[model samples]
Target: MDATAPPPLPTRGPAGSPRGGQDDAAQLQLLSVLHYVMAGFTALFSLFPVIYLVLGIAVLSGAMPVDSSTASSPGEVQLMGWVFTGLGTVFFLAMLATAGLVGYAGRCLAREQRHTLCMVAAGVCCMFMPLGTILGVFTLVTLTRTSVRQRFAHGAALPPSTH
Candidate 1:
């Protein structure tokens, strides 16, 4: 209790014990691997937006023509179709890019790098996708913290290395 003594550092686990001194590293590694696998699945499913866009364009452009009885002249129909097709293509590419970026961010996390910037970028790209933005935002939030960042990078909850 000497006044000159520096304050004790906070303990992270059981009383008078350091963290990750046992099986924690292995558990963290497994979780990291699982997170990456889930991210891969997310990336694959995100492609649906792109597929929808292509199908929409095809239908609109008369490439996959609708019932003949419902349309007037093909020329007017074709012009209208092009507009919808173009819009669909734009949205499709946007969604695809979002998914790809998020997938890449997940890979970065699994590799144990500082993924905050990448996650933020992925989240930004996913703003247009319905659930994508929400998931990306969650990932970004979790990855931005100091402890979480360290845990991800090293597959353990140890303090960051000074070297």
Candidate 2:
């Protein structure tokens, strides 16, 4: 043996080549819970743009003017209202759909099924920044592990409610 050779990797915990089923199960459970949490937060944040919708409606109805001093013409106000409404509606729908997909991925992760959907959801989640990014990265890493993949492939994981 070389005198300066690095020590061998420990055969334990996640560092081990084949972490036992229990660790894999625990990790999947944790990831599932985090996915649900991120989904809830995403859904909650999705409501913020609703204020834009409300304001747009008010402007369209003439209750709110685009410019208080009337510098802008009615046509401009109408156009702005439509723009706001359209932007708000699109954002709300997109965010809500992402939240639903993430939640379903969490459910699938818990049950060890629909691995492709979970991977896709995790990839989508990477775009949310901060908390979602962290959760998504961790989920992607966990799901790609050999032992974890085996568990998912074999349908050995049970939902938290069942386990």
Candidate 3:
């Protein structure tokens, strides 16, 4: 090569196509789509039991109109409705509590800003069924394994201790 020759520009792979950039963009798009889908699923999943409970209450109270026009014959339906409402209430409370625990774990995880409150909020939200348990478990796992939580807890990175 001539001493005066210009250096070669970095070429894109395979016919000058920017494969890495394209791959990154594709991954971002895929992840965005997944996030949306998961958000929708979580909203629906968390609210379903509550909805069932409310509906059950309405049904039992004769506020919801069923197929039966006879008011006196709402015995079996009322019983079932009450049962469903009771179960739903129990589950809703449980989900809420679980969410709270997970949130605590989250606060314990952040390094710079130790958002114990945020973690508490997260745990509170987790009280709701699949959301609380699933998210809580994930946050808990992340906090337990990483030095982030430990550092945050101590307000500084911990130095290795010699025995």
Candidates in order have lDDT scores of 0.56, 0.85, 0.52
lDDT of 2 by residue, 28-128 (tens): 88889989998999999999989998888888998884565764566888888898898989999999999999999998988889888999999999999
Steric clash pairs (candidate 2):
none
Best by lDDT: 2
Give Cα distance to truth, residue 54, candidate 1, Å. Answer: 4.9
> Considering only N, C-alpha and C atoms within 3 Å, which residue pairs clash in candidate 1?
none
Candidate 3 regions with alpha-carbon error over 4 angstroms: 1-45, 69-73, 111-163
RMSD of each: 7.9, 4.6, 12.3
Name the top TM-score candidate. Answer: 2
Q: For model 2, give the 10-residue run with minimal summed lDDT.
A: 10-19
Give the per-residue lDDT of model 1 (tens digit) for 1-163. Answer: 8999999998566421345423334433443454455456555655665665666678665578666677777766676667666666776566566556555655555455655655665456456455555555556555565555555565543456576
Evaluate candidate 2 by giving its C-alpha RMSD to the native, one decimal: 4.6
Candidate 3 per-residue lDDT over residues 51-96, each given as its tens digit? 8799889988878878876545668788879888999998777655
Mark the 10 consecutive residues where model 1 has the least summed lDDT. 15-24
Q: How high a TM-score does candidate 3 get?
A: 0.43
lDDT of 3 at 162: 66
